[model samples]
Target: MNKRTNYKQEKRMKELEKQKKKEAKKERKLNKERMETDGGEIAGQEEMA
Candidate 1:
């Protein structure tokens, strides 16, 4: 019983790690896109000025 519980805990931790990594990757991509668009907007404003 102890071994089985330990195995399950290990498996669950691996799954959690994978989920967190995926979420972090998505967040990073979103931030990158926002940064890119912000730069574009600034350039556009500068050109208008």
Candidate 2:
């Protein structure tokens, strides 16, 4: 029974980790897109100045 509980806990922890990683990846992708768009505008303004 103890070993089974431990196995379940480990499985749960792994699932949580996977979810965290997926969220982090999605956030990074959004940030990268935001930066690209914002950075392009800033660079264009600088060039004009």
Candidate 3:
């Protein structure tokens, strides 16, 4: 019983992590586009980070 619960919890954690990564990627892409539209300096700062 405990083992099953642990497995489910781990799976849930992994899914959450994956979702967060996807959202972050989308945000970065949007930021990059916005930066390009504005100026190259912001994009360069993103690369540095």
Worst 10 residues of 2 by lDDT: 1-10
For model 2, how does the per-residue alpha-carbon lDDT over 1-49 read when each residue is reduced to its tens digit?
3546588888999999999999999999999999999999999999999
Give the local distance difference test score of model 2: 0.95
Query: What are the runs in model 3 whose C-alpha is more than 4 Å off?
Result: 1-5, 40-49
Model 2 TM-score relative to the real fold:
0.76
lDDT of 1: 0.95
Tens-place lDDT digits, model 1, residues 1-49:
3546588888999999999999999999999999999999999999999
| Higher-scoring candidate on TM-score, 1 or 3 | 1
Q: How many Å off is the CA of 41 in candidate 1?
A: 0.4
TM-scores, all models, native as reference? 0.87, 0.76, 0.69
lDDT by residue (1-49, candidate 3, tens digit) is 3546588888999999999999999999999998787788777789999
- Candidate 1 wrong stretches, greater than 4 Å: 1-5
Runs of candidate 2 with Cα error greater than 4 angstroms are: 1-5, 47-49
Candidate 1 positional error at 47, Å: 0.8
Clashes of each: 0, 0, 0
Q: Evaluate candidate 3 by giving its C-alpha RMSD to the native, one decimal.
A: 8.3
- Quote the lDDT for 33 in model 1: 100
